[model samples]
Target: MRRTFLTSMALSMGLAAGVAQAQEKSLTLCWAAWDPANALTELSRDFTARTGIAMNFEFVPWTSFADRFLNELNSRGKLCDLMIGDSQWLGLAAENGHYVKLNDFFEKEGIDINDFLPATVYNYSTWPKGSPNYWALPAMGDALAWVYRKDWFARPELREAFRKEYGRELAPPRTWDELMEVAKFFTGREIDGKVRYGVAIYTERGSEGITMGVTSALYPWGFRYQDPEQPYRMEGFVNSPEAVEALEAYKALYECCTPPGHSDAYMVANLDAYKSGQVAMQMNWFAFFPGILKDEQVGEVSGFFVNPRQNEEASVLGGQGISVVSYSDKKDLALQYIKWFAQPEVQQKWWALGGYSAHRAVLEAPDFPESAPFAGDFLEAMSNVRDFWQEPEYAELLQAMQRRIHDYVVADKGTAKEALDKLIQDWTEIFEDAGKL
Candidate 1:
């Protein structure tokens, strides 16, 4: 969902040294500049102090992270020694031989692989399963979940009104239909004398914001980006009859319920609106939840819930684990740092620093602060999360799907079927060209 993962054997980087490398090898790393990245950077500083390996981070803007990493890695440029790429980049990086295997390192450090959530570790670690090697340990686990203004929803009059209107009591929604109903319920509702919208969704096109935001909704309606018969191939699900039905439902939900200029919404936009008390419920990634506690204005009353789906099985695929580049000169040091970070104490530190933990035990830790408010809900949802594109051409395939979703949600250029059909054609062509069809 955000910038980008694994593999086997004792693969060693080319090395010739009679040289006393500086007390610490200065390794350059790149990752997104969001709160989680900040949290990890703090951990990296601790790493620097101990090993004198001197890790330096380059915080790239999400806007151009892909192009920037590509320009560097493709040219064998030295700008980045270790990079945290978007999830979609995993297959490409692995295929391109840009990552080092980590299984040996884990064993050498005496770190138990089972300590991590298999869902988070397996996909990000290995290129193809059954390989004894791995690429990256999942640096963080992420999923889509919603948080709401409990105070407003709990008001006696509002609950009665919702009960009358929907034939049920007001509680966090359990289905897409209920999501719409609740979003509509609070869209123009006044609370504490301020007008508020019901929900905030990301629609921006700069990167993959639109897709990242919509995939959670898309999966629940029996929407599949591709036919299962083929690998690395996508169908025109975005514009399919079912997908269209979902999109129509989405259009109605957003049109009737979101704040002004919401058509331009992105993660930060939604966060800003929710923080400002301009929306009653907002869906976002977990990393931003801690900020609510510090923002003060809307911090005191927000409650959390898992996103609802039409099917009882929740429909969402979250972001993935991070990896070290195989091409880096500092593989040994990078492995060392990841080992330190994998321990329970370090992961707990990551959570306290507002970093989303891909380590399940740390997230589910019983003593997790209630002060942060939404921590319990997030840990619970993390257990059931999924990730998309278990194929090699994952990035290009994802881009194609986003293009079709954009057409349905933004351009209004054609029916969801028409747009999705085109995407399927486009994706099929790519697969055919790659001999994956």
Candidate 2:
């Protein structure tokens, strides 16, 4: 009787241990709470089904996303097994050991970083800029692009009026000067019994909104962060005559074309303005393109285009890389997830589910251009993208630019040249402090 009772106890203990092990097979992926997050949640179900591992998510709003996740990473908290961190965070995360370096794991699993888009791999994974030291995988590919009201542009009266005024067909502008002309023509115009503004640009003062928006103009007007040969030297390149002109042009657009009371507008605000027929065009990231195309009110009328060219073609890069949190206990499980996600078929499905896939196999496929109305434009924008500072001091550098540019462009505090000059001073001090100078 004693032997039989001991046998039953041992069997019960084994069952309990099995249940605990099964529960431990789960992973939590953290990212911003947006349309792409919802798509990722759906796509992860396939990962769970294939590996018998449950997926968990802790998504935060965009406004608080960086602060929340950075705090978690800084504290070495085990909140997330995987993190889809912003591209700008790569330098800090890698240097601070917040993310696991996956070079060996990638090699063992036969995952080629080369299979991803070169721009994404360069921006999203490498810590030392163009080095091979990868700490993440490019999960979402994005760039700043324009979406205009095609239905409005196609109107005969408007077309003839625009042609007469600008000496060109009322089509998407291929140059910044032409874009300005188009904006001037559309501003204060009545469309469908409503007064419509020319554009909804990124003028939000509080965060990275305005910087991203203004950089689109700055890049085409030949702005560079530093002398390519001598890094951290910002005087000539950052505040050049061309860059000042670009800044002035951006300010002009904001003052003359944007909707009334749009002094502080960002992605959601711009989207709202465009959807309500308050604006003729909106500048936004391609990540939101899928949702915009599916929007009930403005979906059918919207047409996409790459950023207009000036002295050069360029667009602001926007996206995140997926990284394994070094603090997590489930490192092996997180690696498995990355391995599974790198598969071409899975990446194609990721795109289908509304998440931008950075894999070349998905992007370069013959059917890719026809996959969505905005796909071709997305490809074009990604090809000539530029990113802000990705050093460990990225936040400091970004904040400095934000203050200087916003004071000038929105508050009307200084001249374009003065703003850029002050920006150079701020950046020089930062780099000097970090001993990069």
Candidate 3:
């Protein structure tokens, strides 16, 4: 009887220990459902193999990504141990305690922020813009970039026609004016017996699409969110002459160059249009470039370039940083994952696996530019990239820009000046309500 009791007790204890171990070894990472998420999943297998930590992923489509994950973070849910969140969410996540500050962990692990691209560090990791207060590690680096049909540009007949008309070589555009001319040249032309359009740009109104697209044009044309000297004072800056001209230029491009009924297009719609050979050029994030290069339809014929210069060179920043969820019980494991991920070898492997490594070791390698067709353009774009407001009230700021810009650019409801003036009014109200004005 004694032996039987001892055996039963041992069995129960063994099962409990096993369950505890299993729980400690598992982790969940959340991000938007996209190519990079898949790459991260593939790359994480090595992490699992090395540390014996199991990783699970929950990926939401981009349309609902911010809503779903922001809600998860706001509600203090433990569904995710790690989150690869958007750059614009850093301030909100840090302020709201959704992300665990990784500064001390980084220092303890000798993970230097200087080793990552400066733009990624600034946009993705830092909460106070240039401060050293880091709530995340820059995981993927991306920017708005242009891709065109190389074969179309190389056609001798088209080149001759473009040169005759525009008095310039038929190459990728070097400036905004040149870009518009090229876009116009291709807007209604017949290519390979099919009618093709000039460009597929962001026009989607519901989310951040139009804001991103409009800002690409706005940035090069010298748009500023507010007076840098007097913070949040957006009166002259947001509705300045340069900014109004940029807005007008974007609206004109949309009306004259885009495909029929492209008023509601964003990333996926642009990708589909490009793949279907409906557009000669497309503006999209560098995160999609890897898949674009491997695409069966237009891969071989595609070429990429940085956003053209206007008054200055600039591109809209895109990408996210990986953070440990502050509410997670598995913080130790999540931190371990960060340490492992920050290694030079791991970063190199990440790049090889189609994940954009912000690590300088990977980006500055001798052969890095030659590693991918778009790598050089990606580097250039990152160097001159700018991001949207990263304030805790970023959603309100973005929504206002979206409404104002979409109404002007897509719906043709007002003049550029009127649209921007209304935007400043909207943003001013938001800031005043937040006590920041």
Candidate 4:
């Protein structure tokens, strides 16, 4: 009897150990979790509950996201099992072959990717569209638009004053030109015995913040990076007549309205300014909008609208996507995640957690416009959003463009024409090297 009891106890212990091993192999996910990233994780709770996997999440602020992600990737599969990288990293990651191409898996799993917003998923998740493979899954919803002090806009005193100056009723400016008119009207205006600023234009050269802010203006001015084939190349369109025209307009607005040292600004910089009532408006991401509303300090006065257009409203289609590391040993598990996360139910959970949906159906859900704190504004404003270049060399092209434009507008270095011609020349050369020109 004693021997039989001991044998049964040992067998039970062995079975339990096997079950635990199968359940938790350990998963580490790395991402940028500012508001959007946070929202994605909240959406991921269901996956954790259902799979019984021991998941580890790695989140870094956007401030050092690139460096952090790059370092982790370079660590040779020790850093993470899953990664949701920035759109700009797509090319470099793909070129380096450090990411598991999901095309085969996606097809084998029968994921109808056609349901995703093509412009967004293609640009942010693929290195070169139509290539044999895709690199990641859409991780966040992104669009560029202006966030303003709606409470102030709705104020009777400000409204009357704006109408008197612009010869129109006080309302969201219909165009970029009108946005300037609005900025100038309230900039430096006396309010409750306090001084105020007109607008916040990101000017900081730190990281990619300034670059993103600059491109929000540059692209609509008809700036093209290179011939379509040579996407990585840059040219002198930086000083083009059109390019300069865009900068000149931007410069005029900056001069009269932006806070001091606005040139060194980034996403958070502008948010800080708006939160403090230092700047009346800023061009920023959809992801940040939720945070502005959540933070007690700024929620009282913040407002949002689609990025205003100069000739038309066109903002960079920017955001991040979820991907599996090429060297990840547990790729099947990661693919399971990608497939499950795309479900409408999962998307709705994400929405409830303050995330924007990547799918049109969820974005257009009848209750969405009314349920969340600011869904009405976001859904109404999605029409004006657009995608930036998602090619592998996307950052190189953007940096090249930023350098030229920053010099011209902030430093007053050269005629827009001179800068643009040189930029165009530079970009054309890059195309030639790529055999695209």
Candidate 5:
């Protein structure tokens, strides 16, 4: 009788262990370390509370973020069960099967991709640009937007001076020419009894910072990476006279209007300059706007604008999408996390938590545009967001642009035409090597 009782106890223990193992599923998500990522970590507590699955995160700084995460993806590392990768990485991640296709899961879960903002759905989630080959979910909808000191713009004397000099109201600029004029007007000037520069445009020498910043102006000025119809015929398009002029304008803004040492500024530095009252205007991602609104020094005086236009309005698209790593043993759990994240309530909380949700439901909420100082500009900017290359060789293409543009813009090593001409040559060679030309 004692032997039989011991056998029953051991069987019950083994079954309980199996059930515990099944219910204890967990996942690790990796993303760039920023304010949004911190917010996400806080918001993810809800997911844990509801599902009982554990969540782990790896937050890497923006500078070496791509290098660290890409290496993990390339090696099929199980370290990251999920990743919030840049939109431009979609092409390579999908082509190499580093990401699990989310189409079937979306359909099965009844998560309508249409619920996301159209631009974000196209740029962040789709792999082939316009196709429905979904490999990720639009997590953050971002665009390059402007922040300026409204108190200065509203000053009667400054307004009169600006109107006298430029023959227009000193409101947020509507064109790149006006933007430059605004920048020029404020540089080295005393405002509120403190000297400040005109703007802090991205001129970082490393990585894709310069390209991302310049393209905000370039797209409206008629720069094209390649022939839209032929895709790889980039020679005349990338090096067009209009593109050269745009590059020249970008360099001019950086050299004459920005503060000293801004040649190395990127997102964080630009934000710091604005927060510290060192610049009258700064260009940054919409993701940073909430923090700016919370700032004590600049918040009360801050103003926001969509990217200024030349021939047409355009802003650089800046955001990432959440993806399930293809090699993840916890893919099902990761997918559950994404599904939970895609819900409307979660998206609303995402916004409340400092993440810029791409969900149309949240964005289209009647009060959304007026919810924050920059919300309207965010909506307007998304309407005309332009993206860089989404090719499998995008990193290589981006690196080449970084080198070419930084050398010309920051180092003043070449003319705008020379810089763009060299860029065209570099892109052509890249395509040729990839057998696309």
Candidate 6:
């Protein structure tokens, strides 16, 4: 009888221990497979060391990142306890309750949203445009920027020829027209007896690549979605003549300067072109700048600049915010991770590890802009950052854009005017279906 009782007690204690261990299990974070994700892995080691909660990551390629994660979220898969979602995903995620509203959690934990950059929070965290509803914590702060081969641009012979012909010094361009001229000069030019192309921009057809890349040209040339006082009234706003001109300029840049077989190019393809010495210049997200600055061949020769202006300086925002999956059973544990990440020290380490920290304290550090080659450009670009649609129907809208823009830019099927007109029609259909128009 005594032995039986002891055995039963021991079994109960063992089961309890098992449950406790399971409760303290590792967290899985999903994000795009890129330079920042690598930095995240390194930065997370300290979190694990302090909390004893192992960190697991799901790094999906950017091309398919949205499809994979959105499916996971919609299915309420427990695979990702935390996710670094794109800014445009906030509205859909929040509206559908896929992400936990962070307002109460942030306030309870004393995590001040003011500490993060206003642009980051507005674009990445908030829903309903300027509402106080917070669905995510800004993790990565990014914007479009230009990178060029400084060594080639600085060559006196090229500079002299450029000045003589184009009547301008061969240097980083300050305007899109000047950039086009520079790109023209470098296209198919022999550098070190090897022919290289001029520029590489995102032209990938099946995803958000083309839209994101083209917006660098779009916003500066006067593209606006709708009246600020009204939403879903996009007919004239989207297909305006200025917007048409911008898209034409974008397609022209694609045809004139990019390498052959560049139709499916995005982040990886652009990085490869620069790293392999295949292109003289590239336009990419600022988040990739840290990795570029570390590349052996490209780092020493490269110069960084904000995307050149057309009629004004503007850049497309490209970072993501970390959100807790609403269906996650481990919400408490996820909140713990958020609290840890919000600390100023951790944010500082994030930037040091090549992740762009959105925390104002870290970004505003007196030496922050000078900390890296593209740092100043990043600061300047973020100040003028603009975002695409931030509605619950964003995915539908983005897909429509991908189809229309790709048909024109990559497949060469139609003119910019026709493309934007079709885009306006498509967006109107989506808004109508959503009962917005």
User: Considering summed lDDT, which 10 consecutive residues are worst modelled in model 4?
Assistant: 230-239
Q: Give the alpha carbon lDDT tens digit for every residue of 75-144 in model 5.
A: 9898999899999999999999999999999999999999999899999989788898999999988999
Cα lDDT tens digits, model 6, 276-299, are 998989999988888888888788
Worst 10 residues of 6 by lDDT: 227-236
* True lDDT of residue 43, candidate 5: 97
TM-score rank, highest first?
A: 3, 2, 6, 5, 1, 4
What is the TM-score of each predicted model, taking all chains together? 0.87, 0.96, 0.96, 0.87, 0.94, 0.95
lDDT over C-alpha atoms for residue 200 of model 1:
92
Total clashing residue pairs per candidate? 18, 0, 0, 27, 0, 0
| Better-scoring candidate (lDDT), 4 or 6 | 6
lDDT of candidates 1 onward, in order: 0.73, 0.93, 0.93, 0.73, 0.90, 0.91
User: Which regions of candidate 6 fall more than 4 Å away from where they truly are?
Assistant: 1-23
At residue 34, candidate 2 shows an lDDT of 88
Runs in model 4 lying further than 4 Å from the true structure: 1-24, 130-132, 227-240, 372-384, 425-437
Candidate 2, 1-437: lDDT as tens digits: 99999999999999999989888999999999988999999999999999999999999987678789989999999999999999999999998999999999999999999999999999999988899999999999999999999999999999999989978899988888988988989999998788888989998777788999999999999899999999888889999999999999999999999999898888899999999999999999898889999999999999999999999999999999999999999999999999999999999999999999999999999999999999998888899999999998988998899899999999999799999999999999999999988
lDDT of 3 by residue, 1-437 (tens): 99999999999999999989977799999999999889999999999999889999999988788889989999999999999999999889999899999889988889999999988999999988889999999999999999999999999999999989988899999888988999999998999899999999999988889999999999999999989999998888999999999999999999999999999988999999999999999999999999999999999999999999999999999998999999999999999999999999999999998999999999999999999999999899999999899999998989999999999999999799999999999999998898997
RMSD of each: 9.3, 2.3, 2.2, 3.6, 3.2, 2.7
**What lDDT does candidate 1 reach at residue 317?**
44
128 in model 5: Cα distance from truth in Å?
A: 1.9
Candidate closer to the true structure by TM-score (higher is better), 3 or 5: 3
